[model samples]
Target: MKRIVFFGDSLTAGYGLHKPEEQSFPALIQRELDAAGLDYRAVNAGVSGDTSASGLSRLSYWLSGPVDVFVLALGANDLIRGLAPSGTQRNLQAIIDQVKARFPLVKFLLLGMQLPLWVPGQRAAEFRQLYRDLAAENEMPLLPFLLDGVAGIKHLNMHDGVHPLAEGYQIIARRVWPVLQPLL
Candidate 1:
């Protein structure tokens, strides 16, 4: 069976969710794939608190098996930690390059994250533009904002206001479905 891997940090890991495997956006995507009878398995390779550099470090392990599609969704932690956007972009690009080196035909989808408004405007803009640049350069799909409808909504987020609740993940799943469907 073909495999699609969602590689990222806490958001992709379904942090704060009681039943992550069943409620994470990747898991929901798996359910969609099953219902559509697609011959693919969705692998959730999300690690909480992972930065782009950390994700890049683990890319080799995830690339060990056949990967038909790779959903890149890291960098949030880097943003939170005030890491340079350039560094995040470079690490993300390196991860993609490594994956391509191993699986020349693997497809990619970049799930971009936005820094909260509190961050400096210039840095935030740079961080936001990185994903667009990467997606264009790589000729792959890009989801501009992973938390489009769920972010800042009191009801959708957990108490800490960083992670999404189960209901929020459902919304995220729906938003990601269209982008992922074409890939599948």
Candidate 2:
């Protein structure tokens, strides 16, 4: 079967959800795939609190099998921890490079993340630009902001206001579906 890997941090991992396998965006995508009778499996390679660097390091293991599509959703933790955008960009590029090297035919869908409005201007701008630059440079489709509709919506987020609740994931799944469907 063809495989689509959802590689990222907490948001992709369905953090704070009671039933991750059923509620996570990746799982939700899988459900859509199944409903459409698509012969594909959506693999959730999300690790809560993981950074771009860590994702890069663990990429090789996930590369063991054939990957038809790679949905990169990392870098949020890097931004949250105040890491330099340059470093995050570099790490993300390296990860992409490694994946391409392993699976030359693998398609990519980059999921971008944005900092809260409370963050400093330069940092937030830099963070946002990194994903845009990467997608442009790689000629890949990018979801401008992964949390576009869910962020800052009090009822949709967890108490920490960082992660989304189950309902929020439902919205995210809908947003991601159109982009992912064409890929499949």
Candidate 3:
């Protein structure tokens, strides 16, 4: 089967989920693919607390295998650590570049994150715009906010309020499915 690599941080990793192997977004998508009889596999390449730079550092491992689709969901950790948006953008672009070079036919989907408006700062605005810029420049699909319905929703998230619970992931899966289905 073809591969769809979901690369990102804890959100993509399904952090705090008791059964991440079966509850992560990637795993949920896998179930969808199977139910639809789609000839593809979902590969969850998410790592907890990974910044864009860190994710780039380990890109090769994921690229070692055949990749048909690449879903990027990084940058949250970078924002949390107050890293520069430019640096995060550069690292994310590098990841995209390397993946494209490795698999010319690989489709891409960029998952974006946005800080709440109450979190005041120009940096916050820049962080949100980076995804749009990257998506436009790369001519790829972009999910404006990965945690759209789940973010700030106490019940949908774990105590940490960052990672989503299984139910939250289900909503995420729903949001991503329409965008991802066309690519598949």
Candidate 4:
């Protein structure tokens, strides 16, 4: 089966307390692919609290062989922790390069995140721009604001207000399915 790797942090990992299949976006995407009769698999390579740096470290292990698609959804914790944006960009670029090198025909879909626009600096803009830059450079599919209508909404997020609830996952599935369909 063709494999689709969803590589990222807590949201992708479904960290907000629930069944893996129901909460994780990858599982939802899997169900969608199944219903649509797409011969593909969604592998959740998400590790809660992981940064783009951590994603880089595990790249070789998870990408040891040919992969049909890679959904890069990392860098959130790095942003929350106030890490340098340049480092995040470099790590992601490296991972994309490595994946393309090993699996030349592998398709990529870059998932971007957002932060409070009033966070008191240029951080949100810089972080958001990273996806645009990488997508342009690598010619990959780009999904702006992965959380979209779900983030910060009381009912959709967990008590911590960072992760998504089950309903939020549904919203995410609805949003991502169209973009993911063509890549599969």
* Predicted structure with the largest TM-score when compared to the true one: 3
Tens-place lDDT per residue, model 2, 103-180, is: 999999999998866777887889979999999999999998999999999999999998999999999999999987
TM-score versus the correct structure, for each prediction: 0.97, 0.97, 0.98, 0.95
Can you list the residue pairs that collide in candidate 1? none
Q: What is the C-alpha lDDT profile of model 4 across 1-184, one tens digit per residue? A: 8999998988898996559766688999999989988889899989998999988998888887558999999988988898888888999999999898889899899998767677666776788788789889899888888999998899998889888888898999899889888887
What is the TM-score (0 to 1) of candidate 3? 0.98
Task: Give candidate 2's whole-model lDDT.
Answer: 0.94
For candidate 1, give the lDDT of residue 124: 91
After superposing candidate 1, which stretches have Cα over 4 Å from the reference?
116-120
Model 3 gets an lDDT of 0.95
**C-alpha RMSD for every candidate:** 1.1, 1.0, 0.7, 1.2
CA shift of 170, model 3, Å: 0.6
Output the better candidate (2/4) by TM-score.
2
- Kindly report the root-mean-square deviation of model 2 from the true structure over all alpha carbons: 1.0
Cα lDDT tens digits, model 3, 85-129, are 999999999999999999999999999999887877899889989
In candidate 2 the C-alpha lDDT for residue 105 amounts to 92
